[model samples]
Target: MKNFLNKVLQQHSLIYKLILYVLTVVLIVFLFPKGGKFKYDYFKGKPWLYENYYAPFNFAIQKSQETIDAEILEIEKNSTLYFKFDEALVQDVRSNFDERIRQENYTSEIVEEILPIGQKIISSIYDFGFIDSQSESKLTSETLEITLRKGNLAFNIPPDKFITSTELLQFISSSLANSAPVELRSSMLNILSEVIRANIHFDEEFTEKAKEERIKNLSYTTGFVAESELVILKGDIVEGKKLEALNSIRRELESQVWSESNYNWVVFGYSVLVALALLMLLLFLRKYRNDIYENSTKTTLIFLNIALMVFLVTVVVKIDVKYVYAVPLCILPIILKAFFDARLGLFAHVLTVLLLGFIVPNSFEFIFLQIIAGIVTILTVSELYRRVNLFISIGQITMIYMIAYIAFTIIQEGNIEELNWFYFRLFAFNGVLAFLVPFLIFLYEKVFGLVSDVSLLELSNTNSTLLRMLAEKAPGTFQHSMQVANLAEAAANEIGANAMLVRTGALYHDIGKMNNPMYFTENQSTNVNPHSDLSNVDSAGIIINHVIEGIELAKKNRLPDRIIDFIRTHHGTSLVYYFYMQEKNENPEQVAIEKFRYPGPNPFSKETAILMMCDAAEAASKSLKEPTAQAIDNLIEKIISKQMEDGQFMNADITFKDIVVVKKVLKKKVKNIYHVRIDYPE
Candidate 1:
């Protein structure tokens, strides 16, 4: 039991990776639509490449969405508008009219005559049913008729037959114009205005309900497809009815309800496919990118990016499948290439696209477009810290999407007239969103405690806080660092290593020397050696402690670990020979060698190794009595060789050939620095 617990503790990284993989798989599968996918790939107007197809079961041939939409539009335009006829409202208006007449205290003869006229007007208005002006305006100008329902009977009448408020007043005025004198007619108009009400109101509820009933009656499927019926022959063009039939089967298969056993099988299938795609990514990392694979953080970043891309695409597909291309899948490759490398980025992008193929519509086109865009991203998006480069790359990617889509449309339709302008808009939108990559990278750096070239460029500036302090406190060491930076950068470029990384690392590698700058020979202006007063052991300790102090200072300043690596490894574990030998000769019996050595895990990458080589070569070249080409060459060889003998570069991923090329670069750069000229012939 103790051994089991110890084993679990020891393999925690592996366990974490396993958990990440499983969760990624589960999340992606969960994001996928809970439906079976059609196995065969088909396109309208394209030849059916598979064997003669048949309906697996009876299913109705579903109508196209355009057809269904057209049908609905027709129904909306021609459907009957309903209005409720209120028989009781007419009585209420009459009663109010009588009350108004009584309140006005009209003469009996005038009232008797006006009352009949008012009743006639009310009966006339209610005959066709008086409607509110608002409802009348809502009735389409082209609508010739409306259905007026009174009790259980519905009457189809011309919409103009119904009286609006304006018509009602006009009717009252015309009816009173002849029946009453001017004074009586004016008084009657005032009474009628208050009592008259719209007896027929638009029945929006009944209208909508009726429209819904009609729509429900509209056939979603035109005809039934019999089981085992030959749908389409192989090599037949998938057009018209054949296309419709094929699509109908696909729809039926996708939409059909699955039993518990079948549902579990489908879910399991999705899980397997998703797991396999991620597993391939893991295997590729393990085989070719073991450096990234071994570092759990880096591995997590890669998986997280993949999962993020998948999530974005899945969400978009869920909202609307046609807008699937609008997702900036290229951002994944752009970010990965910025932080890691192009190969890994492209590989991860391809895997992500392949996984998305299970969800997005037109899987072939989606996969092709995304993978192509990812490739373009990897190829074109260099130095992402530069805004213009990222913008230009995104433009190129957008153009590629537009061009590819146009080409596909031409192939599918045999013309450009049917090109979807909507997709082009989506692609443009996708490009706009890609501008977020830099901001996202900045966020990632903060979150993950990783550094990118952008941050490195910022640090490389001497004006930055920590670097400025280094320049102010230890000017000579700063100058030395600058020279080493140039040399290391040149060597890194020669060997195809991370030149910016090595250059930045070289700049801050010796920052610790600022603490006791004058103790070092370079910072002393006069013939004063601070080390002369101290015993050689203490002097060696001071010299060796710079690496340690540099690490502490870097941490205090919150320097990225990548830069701190140079400070930790510039001197490696080599002995401070001058002090060690001085102590050895004076007090040979008491000398302790370990006290003189720089604590180190050594340089573990090409960038760190380059810094180590350049730092040593630059500091040593200053000791040359007469700077000559041969003297410089011998100095470079001896120093590099001695360091090689001590196995300073064994752990670093630098080959002997890389070392030889780096040595050549260092020799040229050193000679240039010292102004070593060739001997003139007499």
Candidate 2:
């Protein structure tokens, strides 16, 4: 498992490393508990019940039971029947009926009355429910009488006034004494007994009605677990405590797991990935190493730049800072100038600015500002002739930054009043940071061995290290390269190509000419021509060996691949026509022109094609005498047209139109090089 993990880490890219860091942070924040407790309190008051049941009865005496019944019937004729009786008794048969009445009222008022009483009962039960188990009398009881009475007034008074204890008992006894039905008498007695035990009182009719209503609503107030029951006094405080304890335990468990988890592994993994990416970048740089240029310093600069990017990105996530996407943009140019050439820096800057949109996520406005500002920064510093002026670059960056901000605001349809300060601050911050660019370069160079685009320009000068070596060791080849540099640079500028590439390519194009210097025409002072003594095949072989020798020399010197590619592909597969023709004349129909061809993969790019055309045109134009504009134009046109026919431009991206422009520009430049002055006749 460890080996697999290490292998994966070794293969991971910078983007993958960044993604891992972000995921780790998310896991830490969300999956881990914050180690805080949660508490909640609930207060539930008891529901109340109102109304009560009561019995009403009257005494009656008669001569006979039949007479008494007839009198009750006459009384009932005037009033509604409101009693129950049993008819089986045969003694005196004097019967009187007693009726129990139940009161009906709104449930809310009933609840109000019952709640306080319920609360009292609950409190008593809680206080006494758990008496000593060892005791014989573990339960307690109490008895009190309740009275029921009808008011003299038509309307019912409040319950406290309408009923009295003496009245209820007296009414029950009197109803029993009369010729009352046994069933009615029994029911009244039972009700009186319960009322007495409860120690409460109510009007007869109202109490009976309330008892009936309570029975109907029994489901609302009964059958709850005794412990879980809530009354106004007890509230829900006990339940809340249990819930809070459960929550605290859950939180504690989460905190314990999070604190004990191996978080450092995540950090170590990400650090290792970053280290590996830096190592790869270093290896890539080393392949292009040059002794004359401080390659060590250049590699250091690149490393520091990558470190700064990682730092900035990490800080953004850690602090949760918002809307500073342009920070990466401000750092990119410095990085590009350090590791690669300045022209390549410009390209990288453009790509980096475009990528800022994805990095910032939904920040299109900032992305636009970065792109415009970056392009301006690169273009302002593009001219190799100008010294790097931080103030001027800042000024250009500031202008572009402001323009981008304003344009973004306008495009978004934002209000100027609301957004003006934001735009100003953004632009100001970026401008100030832009000024710090030069300082950053210095820091990069000091710490990381950075080489600036300005330094590269100085290195491209004629008196530079490689050029000096060439001049001292191979003067004729040096002169030849200088002439080629002039022509190629002019053609590059005229055709809107990379003039630096042309100039740099030209400078090293004939470093191969240095090997067997006298074997080539440029190094021969006298026309003794060593090749004159050799056979045509042997001479061609020696000439072809120079290209191979040049490649070997370039590698030993550790020249960049871009320069070496130019050296290898400049002649392409074009025939060494001069030598081929010489061999053909001697051998008649037997000589193979293919044998005399320069070993090449052909000019596979526009830069190499430019070098090839310029080298051939410059060398050929030297043979002209009394050169005129027309003559130079015709000569350049014929040379490039011959190369095109030979398929030298086949693999290159250069177009027919580009070739036409190259021809016209090369003609003008060659005419200037070979132009004649007025003759003074003797």
TM-score against truth, every candidate: 0.79, 0.51
Clashes of 2: 24
599-671 per-residue lDDT for model 1 (tens digits): 8978889999888888889999999999899999999999999999999998898999999999999999899
Please report, as a residue range, the 10-residue window in candidate 2 with the lowest summed lDDT: 90-99
lDDT of 2 at 609: 87
Model 2, runs deviating above 4 Å: 1-311, 320-362, 375-381, 388-393, 403-456, 592-594
The Cα local distance difference test for each model comes to: 0.88, 0.55
lDDT by residue (tens digit), candidate 2, 264-354: 6544543454444434443444453332123334433443354455346435633543436435465576447444555545544544334
Q: Candidate 1: minimum summed lDDT over ten consecutive residues — where? A: 252-261
What lDDT score is found at residue 263 in candidate 2? 55
Quality of model 2 by C-alpha lDDT: 0.55
